[model samples]
Target: MSIALPQLKSIKIDKFILSLFSAIIIAFLFPTGAGMLHLKQVTEIGIGFIFFFYGLKLSFTEVAQGLKNYKLHVLIQLSTFVLFPLILLGLKSFLIGLIGETFWIGLFFLAALPSTVSSSVVMVSLAKGNVPSAIFNASISGLIGAFVTPLWIGIIVSQSGGMSLGDVFLKLIIQILLPLVIGLLLNKKLGHIAKKNSSKIALYDKTIIVLIVYASFCTSILAHMFDGISFLNFVFLFSAVFCLFWLVIGIIYFISLKLNLSLADRITATFCGTKKSLVHASAMVNIIFANNVSASLFLLPVMLYHITQIVILAIVANRIGKRTLNEAA
Candidate 1:
């Protein structure tokens, strides 16, 4: 007898859902093996290379032109590096008693990360906005994140009694800065090569990101990150995060409309200004946590937030993109 299985019905899985699955499986199923410790070192080194490759792909020509659009660039960067962090900090007063220092700190870290590369660009492109601006802003955000995100984490965690300022700077420079600078200096040559092999390079880029996702979850599981986290507390934290992001997106949209920017510029403001990067989030975790429980569990909020943002933004982006395209036609 031949048996047939039902088709998986094109179930739309968001990036966050896939990432959350990876995080949970790593935390609960695998736990920590001897191999996991070694993987951490490999993960850090791999992340550096990831940024290096990022440098390789950047076109100086694009950056030169992107600089001319300084007003837009500054707006995106300020919204990402400044306005967003304040909101996360403001929540700390309310969140500390409710979710404890771990969740609060993790949320703060998520706020501090730069705007994302892939999703930000994709959303902007779909809405028929400034693709070149998205690319320029995302790349500049990553470079600054190599410093700002870690610096933000280091300062916050110190008051909470975890990592040191000097330690964080060292890791940021060596793990992130050095490679990125080398890649930048060599970009003119490397950029052409990268363009020629863009598809192959993306495969490598994805592999590195998957390794980071797996390692972070594995470490969290090994440390029993959920040990003291009650189900109710988790539920509350999730609700808070969902509300926080939607509010920010709405506020950005309203402000852009007030600014009277074109619909395309407004779309760029909403997408590039409101999102954070998973790649940078995972990398910054390496700089913050020194011990097991603190390091592993501290990563939870950002992990969860990544998924939440993706799922929500997917619906919003689709809706906005369609309307914008129809009007243009």
Candidate 2:
């Protein structure tokens, strides 16, 4: 006789998610060891290559095809870069009082991030969404966020920390944008190879992300940055991230319905619009909050939201997939 695991036990968790939290725990326990200057150097180089590989994967033809749905694209992008930030802006005062200014700024930073690339596409595809549009939005959103995220943060975070807007932009250009352009330029030669090895490339991205997380957390713990955060504060931050996520999800659903979007388009909008890029968040934090004591605390909201979205969207996508399968039957 064969037996199946209980449904909850059977649910598959991404290994990378496990790796992410492991990195954090390790950072906390072995903070001194991982906080070496050499690890920092390796992390920077790894970040450049992450964006470089990302650019190599983007196909101009796919982007052109996706442009036909310009209205949908605009809506998703606005929801990503504008609506999310505005929601956080309105809640800033309250959140600051509850969690303090550092965490509040982190929340705002999370809102300003772009839609995730791989996970957004995977969720949309699983939900029987417009795969091409999802790919297009996810790809372009990162480039847009490279510029807009810094600008948004600059308006609030003063140059007092020696992190002027110009300094941030310079780092952005050097670390993220320049490598991306080089990769794009070489895409004709490398794109097919990159596509064929996409899984390997994704592994590289995940590895680098884990390294960055470990480094950030190590730095923060060593600096005693999280000493004041209580268990209640943790609960509040988790709740806040969940609510922010659902707010974007709800608004996107309403807009899709109002526009009479097809089921696929609706799914694409929902997944892409509501997600934030942890890759971009991790890479940007190195530059944006470099050497800052609270750098890891700044990552708290983004990291929590990242895990929350993946778990929630996986279930949602599976349900949508089942419903679509039934309709065909």
Best by TM-score: 2
Alpha carbon lDDT at 257, candidate 2: 95
Off by over 4 Å in 2: 1-6, 159-162
Q: Count the backbone clashes (under 3 Å) in each candidate.
A: 1, 0
Off by over 4 Å in 1: 1-11, 14-20, 34-37
Instruction: Give the whole-model CA lDDT for all candidates, comma-separated.
Output: 0.75, 0.89
Q: Pull out the clashing pairs in model 1.
A: 16-307
TM-score of 1: 0.88
Report the C-alpha lDDT of model 1 over 103-153, residue by residue, as the tens digit. 787788878888888788887887777888888888788888877877777
Q: List the residue pairs that clash in candidate 2.
A: none
